[model samples]
Target: MRTVKDAWMMVQSEYRGNKLKLVWASLFSIFYMGYIAFFVGIMMNEIVQSNEGHMAVDIMLLSITPLMGFVLNRSAFKYWSEDSYTRMLVYFKSLPIPATVILCKRKIMSVIAFSINGTLCFGLIYAFSKNMRAEMDLGDYIAFTITWIGYGLIVTGLYITFELLFSGKIYLVLTLAVLIVAFGVAFLVQMGGGNLFLYTILCSQEWGLLSPLMWGTLLVGMASVQVFSKWTIHRLKSRDLL
Candidate 1:
């Protein structure tokens, strides 16, 4: 309990004075979702649902929440890597916590962020369901949301590992550009996996049995995150912090 509290404080500390950014971000989420619910939803309903291809666009949008989270998570390691000049590293290291614990907390934060986005994404889908004339019911909605989160966990591990490897003292713009390209390519790959997962989930609903493959995929995703967390800690122990 105490460790969780400490980690929460560490995460919150990053936002020390970034009030405006937080407010604006929250506002943007609200407005973007509201616009989708009212306007986009209505227009999207016009499309006749003939084939599974009708859901391609929605699945693509659903993938973005985690892809963005993966990039956003780099901020944590970016700060850690810049500790020599930033000196914020000293404060974090001085805590009784190990480097791995700090990273675990960051991963937790990423999951939480993705959870909120997934919830909103689910809401957006349901809002437009009638318009899109979606055939999915409430149970399918729950499964989809939970499955996306598992996928997000896998994505978070993969991207953060890459971030820790390539991150260094470089121009922020260049770094972002590199990440944008990388994320774009990765999103393409993830979309393929998500498409398969979604189709399976939709089909299995008729039989009222989610296949073991789905559960296995979720387990693989969870394991990837756990393994990578340990990998990050091992790497951290060997590196010197400024």
Candidate 2:
């Protein structure tokens, strides 16, 4: 059996050897970050400046980063799914290493990727938030920043769990549909004077409500990721190559 160090090498070597993949993966994330910077940060900043009553626009801009973070997380797990036709995963399965170990490594990788993506997303928003922050208290700014990062990490874990057990089509369909429906429901909440976006909640001084839901759902979603990891290992073991 290979040592943990050997398994680490196996994974890292694949990444190091594939420079093009490394570049493509990076560009993929850069694309999303750039989109948020221009469309969300710049355009939305202008919108808020001109149309101050549109809380929904600001809220929607805040939500996209975490949703993109979720997309980044899903990409981490996609290679392991049967749909990707990626050979490294197949190679890993044939080795003597434990599947649980492999799962752990992948989870670590996902967390690192999520953190980097979260930081970039945060930085972009913070840049745009400069003028807005001038009006808000320090404590609220801190809370808002933490809440944004917390939501990004939580949403990423949720999607990683989804990718583990479901087919690509199922993952894609359910994910898009659910996010669409969530915003739809959120719109109603906005219309009814009970905004569901965290940015709105915090700005409205309703962090009491948003805090529990954010932390509570995040705790539960993280737990689900652990369960999904073990379940995915069992699935890989039982699944036939043919």
Candidate 3:
């Protein structure tokens, strides 16, 4: 219980330390998602441009939510890798909090940020778009939002694992290599030239049920957990930050 309390306090401290960045990050997320939704709303409305256009607007808006979520989550990956924060993480591990507990608190902070931005984005879309509650039921929208959050968590976890996998100057090389591989695989999947790759799985089916989005999210999350556990154990053993 005390450990949990300590973890919470640490989270509060970190949040206050980056309060300015948090404000900007929140603004950035809201504005970024708003921009995506606005363009998509325009595209849908222009194509239909009638009462019947409401369905088109709703469809496009809901469909793009996950993609917007993806963009915001990608930004967070880079943010965590920034030098000062990375050093902060090293310092954090030097503290007495349980490793898993600390990691969970960090992830919770991320989820809060993602949720704040996502909700704002959705609110902006609903307010400004023609389909404000027209095409989908509220229940469906809620489910989509939850799934979108799950997607963000999976992406964030994978990137953190990527950072932990390499060390020193080699990490820069590893970062570029990982980005290249990820994008290359994505492009190949987009071009229909890949088989059973992560991107291929993502592009394989619809967004619901046992779709690539959900399953791939689970797979990536599980993989990251395993890799992260190993990495954390090694880091604790070495007691080295860089």
Candidate 4:
């Protein structure tokens, strides 16, 4: 469709002169994930071999894998910041294309980035698990990878909404505050011996790949994307981007 073509063109325009940056980003993301995989492999080996309480640690690592996409491939956030700085949103708004198309380009880029990041993170983990003769199988790896990608997409949608709604120093401050709150909550949960929602979802494979929780996670992710996309478009159209 022409709309999809326009969105793709917009994405291309954003990366027009940033091929080198993209390459570096890709390499950095790979190296970062490689380091995590190595670290996780070491921890997994020790945990699997020991009879200590490793379930919490395993849950923490598995929960963190999906979030690594956001931490490493921050290109989407950077691009949004750049667009805001240059008033590119205003320029795009002046165009004949719908606001949905304008935002679609960013979402497409996000999906691509998160998919690659999620695959590398989980693929490397799976490779290490197999080498250690861990209990995981290809099916479990596939389910984890898909679920992580879905969770990444859902987080990206919320992140994009925040970027659109807030800009400049306010956004930076808010982001820092959010990180603090998240870390604080996580620490509390760990101290209290409470399980993370992600832990439940990730371990849902024990009931097989056809688990209702897995399906629900995917459904929630898909629905969240749709809701966030519509909300973003509405906000962009109503905002005075000038």
Top of the candidates by lDDT: 4
TM-score of 3: 0.58
Distance from true position, residue 167, model 4, in Å?
Answer: 0.7
Per-residue lDDT of 55-173 in model 3, one digit per residue for the tens? 33333432343333232443345543564335655766667456666655655555565667667765665455565345434544444445555554555554454444434345456
lDDT by residue for model 1 (12-80), tens: 766677876567665665665555445534434443244333343444444453553531333444553
Off by over 4 Å in 1: 15-21, 31-48, 52-65, 68-91, 94-97, 131-133, 168-198, 201-204, 207-214, 240-242
lDDT of 3: 0.51
Per-residue error at 46 for model 3, in Å? 6.9
RMSD after CA superposition, every candidate: 5.8, 5.0, 7.3, 4.0
TM per candidate: 0.65, 0.68, 0.58, 0.75
Candidate 2, residue 64: lDDT: 65
Instruction: Show model 4 residue runs off by greater than 4 Å.
Output: 13-21, 40-86, 94-97, 129-133, 188-192, 197-204
Clashing pairs in 2: none
- Predicted candidate 4 versus true structure: per-residue lDDT over 1-242, tens digit per residue: 78778899877876688887778777988997877777776665565455233444444453564355453444345644554522556666667567778777766766666677777766786677643345556675576556656655555566667666666556567656655555666667767766443354346558557656566766787677778878988877667654
Clashes of 4: 0
Candidate with top TM-score is 4
lDDT of 4: 0.62
Clash totals in order: 1, 0, 0, 0
Tell me which of candidates 1 and 3 scores higher on lDDT.
Answer: 1
Query: Given candidate 3, what's the lDDT at residue 242?
Result: 76
